[model samples]
Target chain A: METKIKEIIKQVKKGDQSAFEDVVTFYQNKVYQICFRVIGNAHEAEDLAQETFIRAYVNIHSFDDKRKFSTWLYRIATNISIDRIRKKKPDYFLDAEVKGTDGLDMYSQLPAEQLLPEEEVESLELQSYIQQEIMQLPTKYRSVIALRFVDELSLAEISEILSIPVGTVKTRIHRGREALRKRLRRV
Target chain B: MSCNKQFINLMHKYLDGELTRTDENLLRSHLHSCQSCQKHFHELKRTTTLLKSSSELQPSSNFTEKVMASLPKEKKRVGYMRWFKAHPVITAAAIFFIFMFSSVFSAWDQDSQLSVSKDKNLIIQEDTVIVPEGVTVDGDLVVKNGNLKIDGSVNGNVVIINGEHLMASAGEISGEIEQVNQVFEWMWYHIKDITKNLFAFTNK
Candidate 1:
């Protein structure tokens, strides 16, 4: 699968327009999901997803074959989404302080081990709540969390995509998870 | 209390399975005994699982087509200016070399005392006229039907008729250099020279 992806990327790099369409077809859903999760809006996610592919197409020559193509695509997607979010809500991070139990920030709080009830209804509710809380996370935290959990990207891959250190990625993920745990606890 | 804080700190790494075997064992034992830490671990695990299990959102229909439509018709070719912008040092060096070459060529042309005359009608005389170094002609030096070469100094004007004028770098002319190779050019030069003397007389 990796070799096939590399082959398609090679074709795309060679100005094979049809091959680019195929590339888009293969990665559109994943790209859209990442954008949607980060942006939390269907319409804006679609626009940003389309923008990501268009940017990738225009700058395809810069794509280094040494790394994964998906990583490059994710980097474009996340950057576009982050830029859009920053533009739309200039003060987004200013209000990033999530209310926590006691005086501590929600990210500093450890999760409590209440076994989630294994019922379909409760599980669905928990899923919805988790999604909502994930959206509420600050853009930085939300980005790493979505890339790690939603996209199943490794810490190293997230680091490469975000152009940050793996340590920073881990810290964001840890904080994001704790933030979600706090939100879930309130529910 | 410090031990509990330490365990809390390691909880994320433990859940990630990034812990060393001994640390993993120690964390496991701590979790087993500490209800709060164990509960926290379970919640973290469940939250991660829920996040991973969330279904992907499908984009609107024709997402691929929209992206394809929006892409540029063709890749932009890197123009010379863009390349220059990318390699400013190389461009600067190239421009410097060109300027240097032209400067050197001009200096050589001046030093050689070549036929610097612009009038194509001017004829070259077989006999070479040389104003030797240290020779200074004070009054107007008019040459008719002969080449005039100046390697020293002329304090007054030099006028040539039907001949070429060559001036070396060491030559210095304090006044005008005029060449008239045709009958009409000679007439015009005289008329202009007479007009100039009239204007000087009028001014005086």
Candidate 2:
């Protein structure tokens, strides 16, 4: 897979624009997941995810060949996400319906009559509550926590993606977990 | 229900699924005996499990297509201009260096025809410049792509580029005589000329 991604990146570097679509298709979910978790908004996450790819495409030459492409991509995703929230307006968090604010929010686009399993519905609510607690964390801790648990990335990988030391990543993840526990205690 | 502080660190490792089996057993035994650690472990577990079970959220179906649709077209020419604009100092330095080297190299090849800086009493033969035996050349004499056979005195420096010199037994030069052939020396000469010009400008 690494070789395949490197080949795709090589093609992108060689000025094959269509080759970049493969890169976008391949990493979109992971990038979107990182952006969504960090930004806490589906619509804006999609926007930022697109921005991440566009930025990646524009700066493809600047992508260092030595580093993992995914790490570089996530770096862009996380930076865009953190930057978005830092330049915060209070309404930036995706409500159940920040309807028509940005077009076709996935949350609103769900079929109205489609039934979900009871267990799944309860679990999704639990997920939503957890997401709220995640949002409450200081933004620094929030990203590491999301990268750790949501992305299920290793501390070393998180360090590379965030350009921080492994020890600092561990400290943030530990502190972030404690913050979540405190917030969860409230509900 | 006091707990060992090390156990708290172990609890974090356990949550990360990083605890060695032996340490895990130790933690398990401690948690079983200690109510405070047990409660704390559960709270930590709840938070971690909640985060770990993050609902795999997918972007809308057209997410990729939308990303594809909106990607700034892979810019070709403008990108260079954009790069140049973004790093003004580097770009300026690069252009200056390139201009200097290019003009130097281009000038190097064209200097095969002989040229001299001062012509007063300086005799020019096809590829030989003669400082006539009896007449005094007034100032500095520069000869390029030729030979200088000097028989008269020069009051200032004599610089020869890609050339040779022959001095008569009576020939006199009051200032330094330098023969510059290598590109490096040419660059140094350029630097000297620039600094001299700058010095003159500053004095003015």
Candidates in order, interface RMSD in Å: 2.4, 2.2
Model 1 residue A168 distance off true place after TM-score fit, in angstroms: 1.5
Sliding window of 10 residues with minimal summed lDDT for model 2 chain B? B74-83
**Highest TM-score against the true fold, candidate:** 1
The local lDDT score (0 to 100) that residue A119 gets in candidate 2 is 28
DockQ for every model comes to 0.49, 0.45
Runs in model 2 lying further than 4 Å from the true structure = A89-124, A185-187, B75-204
Which 10 consecutive positions of candidate 2 chain A have the poorest summed lDDT?
A103-112
What is the C-alpha local distance difference test score of each model? 0.75, 0.79
Per-candidate TM-scores read 0.59, 0.57
- TM-score of candidate 1 relative to the true fold: 0.59
- lDDT of each residue in B100-129, candidate 2, tens digit only: 889988888776788999887688888889
Location of the lowest summed lDDT over 10 successive residues in candidate 1 chain A: A101-110
Docking class of 1: acceptable
**Fnat by candidate, in order:** 0.82, 0.76
Residue range B84-170, candidate 1, lDDT tens digits: 877999999999768855664454345333242232223334644566667777767766566777777777898876677875456
